[model samples]
Target: MDRETRYEDSHVSIGSFVLESGEELPHVELAYERVGPSDAPVILVCHALTGNQFTIGEDEPGWWKGLIGKGKYVDTSEFQIVTFNVLGGCNGSTGPCSINPTTGLAYQADFPFISVRDMVHSQKQALEQLGIHHLHAVIGGSLGGMQVLEWGILYPECMDHLVPLAVTPSLSAYGIAYNSISRFAITKDPEWKEGYYNLEKPPAAGLATARMIGMISYRTDDMFQKKFGRKVKGNPGESHTETTYDVESYLHYQGNKLVGRFDANSYLYLLKAMDMHDISRGRDSIAKAAKLIQPNVLAISFKGDLIYPPHELEKMFSLESMAHFYIVDTKFGHDGFLVEFDKWGPLIKQQLKETLKI
Candidate 1:
């Protein structure tokens, strides 16, 4: 299938900056797109892990399609929606897939390790380039939500409202363990070749396997049970030669779909960024970080989300003063925020209206 027509592409140049590993990154580029009228108040929508600027709307049905439109929850009639592929993302942004000026090839393993803070900093540069001095709201889910939290802490004066959905203040030990294993699966693949695989013959198998592992964590067991259960196929009496559990089929489809569009090296880089996310790191405490964000904060959690559970969200709320917490009771797990957009959309609209004074 042809890639969907993207929102208008734009870029910003970030000056030299030192990474957490003490590597100097000079002239980083941030690729972004904006929808609605430029005169409207800016609402920056950060995409989740493995997501792109299409978060708001795409030519195809996107994750947040229902939440953004002329008359939709985000109300393009009232707000200018800005979405960007994060700094280390594969989608039209500077990442491992981006050509390295020194070698004149994809950065691959040569890309500097990045943090969520670094991603937000690059986005800030994008916003500045666009002349968006202040934001009406910053909204996102999962890893995108992590960016929202970082924005609130790092640039509280830049935004009036913060909406972090289905996310946590930090990756849990269990979360890190699961991600590490997923990375191991990818890196161990014979085709990976330590991130130096041919561009045309990228490590498809390793990337697909990594995506399959992530699909399990993105949704709830209850959802799988309801949709697949223990039913099996593929034997002599089965329906098809490759048919197995429905969940397996689902994961396979998701994995294959991801490999078609994403780069394995970019996946590894973004995953490492997620692992490095710790709101309290180098700060006084989680509470101190929360205190710095004086905006009206909306922290939404999914009851069935094991990755970033409701309890973790509660802890994050406890660290803040103006946090309004909501648990989206659903069997969709961590992805509930994306799947149940109808329910959360209005809530987001209402909150933004109230907070932005629109």
Candidate 2:
């Protein structure tokens, strides 16, 4: 919805897409954006949990513009960049907000659970429809990173390089706990009405609280201390009890921002998918799963990230000769991949140039 430069925007019907859980979406619509020449080397950029296909070129600046564009990491002039809203996303894609073709009503809670592999399978279907069989690189961070990890193993021959940034192969206990807290905050809202409530009366309060919890988990103590600390805003001790501290006001702002633009049910589905992500699931062991990855991968971790710490990504060493690990030294925590792009940009450029020759 923001200002973007020249790009192609369209929706593709991918027919019925089946999830790994055996649940099938009778019809799936994927909204996507493409930039650069059709025949150029392809780089598929998977977005984060709440992100959509609008990677760049919006009237409003894109969420990840710092790592993309003319001279950015995935320069559009050199590589055909592709990004798609995932199968269950609400942004121009078939999601809980989309009407069920059969029942003629929004799917809402009726939408089945999806996994990281399912998300990758959906993207693969859309890409195949466009005749894109090979990718110069597959890159993402956070939830998107999980998809990248799945793509490496699921379609080993489809890409030459894999970049999974600030992500864990599976959600850690702490990660799952955080998601659970967020989900509870949303579901407990009486107005949710089991996900069948009217659009105008959405569970804003619950959704905002959920986002507040997520915001807290996304940053480091140092980052928060530097940005907010115990600093009181205005006469908070007298004027407002709720926003007494700068940190409280900041969290409330973030929560409201997300609620204004995102769907609650979609958030639940995506967070559940994250909880279910495990690169080794059904593969017997991590070593066995690592064997399935064909591309040379660069696994990046942020030093102070509590969500997906650097030590967690070291598990990718199971990929052995095919994987190289790097820790991005930053105080920004898990969000460093987004906030400290200046530091990540050069590393990505160097790796992509050397491996994919892009």
Candidate 3:
């Protein structure tokens, strides 16, 4: 298969799997990348929304390269690192864009909705199939952070440490509003054709608009002001200037870049999964859920993260003795946990060393 059609590292069939919604997928293929020696300590790096299995590579720089290098937080020289595309992702995973083995057609709109719990459970099964029964740590940020929490709560005995960054126990109403608007933008595009359009004619305009909306939420107003201010992309003296603000140009560039790689349907599915993340769903309260986590937990909050501000993560303190929390001061907002490695990397290194006794 072409590189674009499947992951270049490794791919495996997960066989039949059922989602939390009772929808069954006849087959699920997971594309993943594993690094270092198999007998070494295992570190599972869960990706954020739109992220794939390529966490660290030589061909192209990865999204978390600064935090995953040789002597970085994960310390690839000492630990085996594993990462994979989410079940409903387009990057070498089964999703709406993948062919339905039963029908010989793309699942498209027929692909059932999935929740964060479903994603965690599916990953657990996949790891078991790969002969990985335990992990030294599970680390993630943003949506990936939610998965970290889910893994701790769902399979407490499977991991020794859990590091969740820039995420809360559940989605806030404000966060939901941002995600809803992004989804609506995609569905409104005429080319969407109710999610049945061919890949060649997919809703590019709508998906681009959706990405622009997501980009706005990912960064803070202070970050925007500091980075762009009133700067104009070109000569504002031109009477017919099509663009005036540098922020506008940045958002457009980010949107176009994502449109070229991501599938609109996968975007909707993953966002919905993020919205459905709730560690305390049936546990009655956040405190009760925290009690079930057996591993050492580190919760990292970003100062300007409007989506999951430090206050939102205060609930994690209920874990009491097992939990440690830290806030990184930055103007990067929710994306700070991804970009401001200088601020949080030391903490990660310290904690990983303390937890694993490295």
Candidate 4:
């Protein structure tokens, strides 16, 4: 496989730090990679749930390709984009699938529980190692967007501009419930065996089910209706019936693909971290936490995104010192930030020009 086709794996050690659960992770290692020019202005790109460092256009063109390459929104010609798989991700980072240096086997269920702040701290170590004194901007969507918000709060001094797309400060009660159900589905599978299923026979059924649950929320009702709409398209003849609507096939493809690249334990870990994400926790109220953000903030949401509704984003902005907040109207729902790049690319370019003055 080409170097770019294979996942890039690199690590940076973060000296001792205590976790939210009162556990100590000494010398935590973060995994990351850089795209575009080294001397260019730095823009840290955080991926959403299940995403890795391959954030720019590659293979089939990454979800953010439209806005990130040469002469584009992020404009690699002027900005060096750094994307990292989050700390607990299965890609190249230390997660459940990683071998335990002590046990000489995959960490499995023994991997330490982590938090969003913990992930950011690890990324901070990676950035410092790369000689980035400060960032030109921090940008992300969904859970990635949550990381951007955390960056503003935890390391305000290291960032100049903050762009959080399609996300909120904390998971709503509904969101928490959704995650809980997904976790339950995974744990209930016969093959899970408390997160230590046989590697050769992983709990693919459970993981696919969990993904199906998530896909429902990540997209819009209208999109499903238009794409599926109870229409049954016959599949290739086989022993078992293989018929589905366009949307059903799409969802199944997404679910199966996730099971191939992602580990069940890592998915559970990251979901829990997202559930625990509340910027206001012990710091202040939501409004107060938002007020502490000193850098120019840009919060973007999609009109059709039911998962991170536009109103919720507005609530976050109401509490912040924002340079601008925009809702890009689209039918693409939460995934709009990735799919409707044509609309947002120019807008992002405009924002960068005004803020970076490039």
- My TM-score estimates for the predictions, one after another, are 0.93, 0.95, 0.94, 0.91
Worst 10 residues of 2 by lDDT: 1-10
Candidate 4 per-residue lDDT, tens place, 1-358, comes to: 1112222336666666577678775445666767765655678999999788777745557657767776677777677788888888987876788777677888899889999998888788778877888888899999999999999988987888889999988888888888998899899989999898887788888888899889898888898887778776665344364645677688788888989988999999999999998999988788778877877888899987766778876887774545578899887888888886887767667666655743
- Winning candidate number (TM-score): 2
lDDT of each: 0.83, 0.86, 0.85, 0.80
Please write out the lDDT profile of model 2 over residues 182-280, one tens digit for every residue. 999999998799988777888888899999998888889999999887898777557645577888889999999998999999999999999988999
What TM-score does prediction 1 earn? 0.93
How does candidate 2 score on lDDT?
Answer: 0.86
- Model 2 ranges with Cα > 4 A deviation: 1-6, 355-358
lDDT of 3 by residue, 236-351 (tens): 86766486678888988888899899999999999999888888898998878888889888889988788887877776764479889988888888898778687889887877
Off by over 4 Å in 4: 1-9, 15-17, 57-60, 235-243, 319-321, 355-358
Q: What tens-digit string does per-residue lDDT give for candidate 1 at 151-241? A: 9999989988999998898998878987898899889888899889888888888889889988898888889899898776455355555
Q: After superposition, how far is residue 113 of candidate 2 from its true place, in Å?
A: 1.2
The clash count of every prediction, one per candidate, is 0, 10, 0, 0
Q: Is candidate 1 or candidate 2 better by TM-score?
A: 2
Name the better of 1 and 4 by lDDT.
1
> Measured by C-alpha RMSD in angstroms, how accurate is candidate 3?
4.2
